[model samples]
Target: MLLVLSDEHKEHLAFLPEVDSAVVGEFGRIAVEFLRKGSTPKIYEGAARKLNVSADTVQHGVEGLMYLLSESSKLMISEVDFQDSVLVLGFPEDLNRLLLQLYLDHRKEIRQILSELAPSLPHYHNLEWRLDVMLASRALRHQVKPTVSLKLHLESGGDHIARVLQTDPATLLHLIQELERALAEAKTNHCRRILRNIK
Candidate 1:
């Protein structure tokens, strides 16, 4: 998979060329540390002082590297693909190689950290629904009203949460149609390609 870098991220990483290769290595380390532990202002300040650059520049550089590494790791791109992704940044050959090496060395650890940090959200377990029809009410001798009741069961961390919803039959039908449309759209080639790159 080829990772696409946004303009803002490209700009953030622009300062890397001016910095020393050793410093760039340090930035990679800082990026990993930032992922493992949250941001540390003091580390940024020290790096800034050592590099003789503003803390914001150092921060942006580290963040840009973090974004690059995390996205590449998230997609689990191969070494050659990662090198190609960084090549588009217009960095020198050595720098590109260095970035690829950094990613290769730390991809596993970064993936682990990311997995641990991911939010544990509820997922669909089961669904139950009922349809009720009212006919021949006292006020309207020939009236008919249809209602749909839905019970959605979601499982989160081994616990089940049930949500009850009630809606008119027409609205429920519309909702189902919309959901089906969305599912169909998700199956399209464009969406499948995008989803593949995202993974």
Candidate 2:
């Protein structure tokens, strides 16, 4: 997402010890005011009148803000158009892609799973499945080996129909894949049973 900061917001950042507050405050009021209005046109005279500071002071303070923002890792000023006078600041494309993947894994994964399951749900009543996919705790005991467990609840009452545990990470993946194939077979058999009863 593009980074948009208000003139008042920039002024608040002036509190950082490295920036001179007097200069930041004046420049934020005058020069940043023009930038906030959606253009970066030179406004030395207008800023000077608003802040009661010399045009040179406003210019110097704004330069300081630009320098500080340039050094920031969180945001980058991609373009500074001297001709039309505009500033475009945003996250770099690589960083944006990384953030998007993280968002998909953490926030959108469950919704995606549900969407994938939707088409198969209407064939029978009370057809629900719960998958408790969890990681092992970090704390270790002397003889206890680290293991991953998957508990599958194939019915509505929440009774776990199948529980699989494997100590090796590579083996655990294979176990889960086999269990998923078995689950698909079980679901198909269940649908056949429903159709037989109807006939």
Among these predictions, the greatest lDDT belongs to 1
- Each candidate's lDDT (Cα)? 0.91, 0.43
Q: Candidate 1: minimum summed lDDT over ten consecutive residues — where?
A: 134-143
Which portions of model 2 show Cα errors greater than 4 Å? 1-41, 74-199
- Each prediction's TM-score versus the true structure: 0.79, 0.21
lDDT of 2 by residue, 1-199 (tens): 2345566544533332333444444543443343334335357567667667666655555553443333221232233221111122243444334323322232233234334444542122233333344455567443444454444334334333443433555676787899999878867978779766543
Clashing pairs in 2: none
Model 1, span 34-95: residue lDDT tens:
99999989988998998898999999999999999998998898998998888888999889
Error of 1 at 138 (Å): 6.7
Residue pairs clashing in model 1 are none
Q: State candidate 2's TM-score.
A: 0.21
Task: Provide the clash count, candidate 2.
Answer: 0
lDDT score of residue 159 within candidate 1: 95
